[model samples]
Target: MSKRWIGLVVVLWVTACSPIDPKLKQYLVEGERLYVLHCSNCHQRDGQGLRRVYPPLAGSDYLKENLPRVICSMKYGLQGEIIVNGIMYNQAMPGVPSLTELELAEIATYLYNSWGTQTGLIDARRIGPLLDSCARPRPRR
Candidate 1:
């Protein structure tokens, strides 16, 4: 094969492998709305949480590494210390137990794609099973 043909093939392959999903825009819009309603109060509109209190989602290291934990925490709440971008946060974050799987997926998709991360759509189909296995918080002593 010629160099030009090889280059064209490579470009075609890359494009085919990364086609933008049609539902992404819809998901992002819904997610942003839901985040404003359900999460912005604490996490803030820009995802910059209050100083030394609520953890910021903007460029959060915790979010990058803890997708499962984040998912579970959304529905079940979170307690104890968690490191976000090397900062130690020990505050208790209450979850939204009422959010459905689709809602959670939308929110996840927004957060993961917004700020600095680009994790794309977090499908509700992928969310349901993970939520089923969420680890419940222990009762306070």
Candidate 2:
């Protein structure tokens, strides 16, 4: 094939592979709103968190590794000491138990896709199971 044809095929393939999902876009928009209203207080609008107080969500190793725990924590709250980016943070993060699975998914989608992270869409369907797993009672510190 000619060079121009080869380039055209590459471009077409790239575009086809990465089509934007409208649902994801909606999730992101709603998620931002929810984050600002519910989470941005501690995590901050930039997701930098407070200086050594609230853990920074931006480029957070904890967030990246503990997706299931994060989802659960969103509904069940998190207590005691948790480490993010090798720094230990001891804070009582209250969960918004009223947030529906869709809202949780939207917030998560926004968080994972923002601040130097690109984890794509986190579907609401996947959240239910994660929430269920952490529904049991546990001791708090």
Alpha-carbon TM-score of each model against the true structure: 0.81, 0.84
Cα error, residue 90 of model 1, in Å, equals 1.8
lDDT by residue for model 2 (5-42), tens: 99999999998889799898999999999999999999
For this target, which candidate reaches the highest TM-score against the unseen true structure? 2
Name the lDDT value of residue 39 in candidate 1.
Answer: 88
Error of 2 at 64 (Å): 0.4
Q: Pick the candidate with the highest lDDT.
A: 2
lDDT of each: 0.89, 0.92
Off by over 4 Å in 2: 1-18, 135-141
lDDT of 2 at 139: 53
Scored by lDDT, model 1 comes in at 0.89
**Alpha carbon deviation, residue 41, candidate 2 (Å):** 0.6
Report the poorest 10 consecutive residues by lDDT, candidate 2. Answer: 132-141
The all-Cα superposition gives candidate 2 an RMSD in Å to the true structure of 4.3
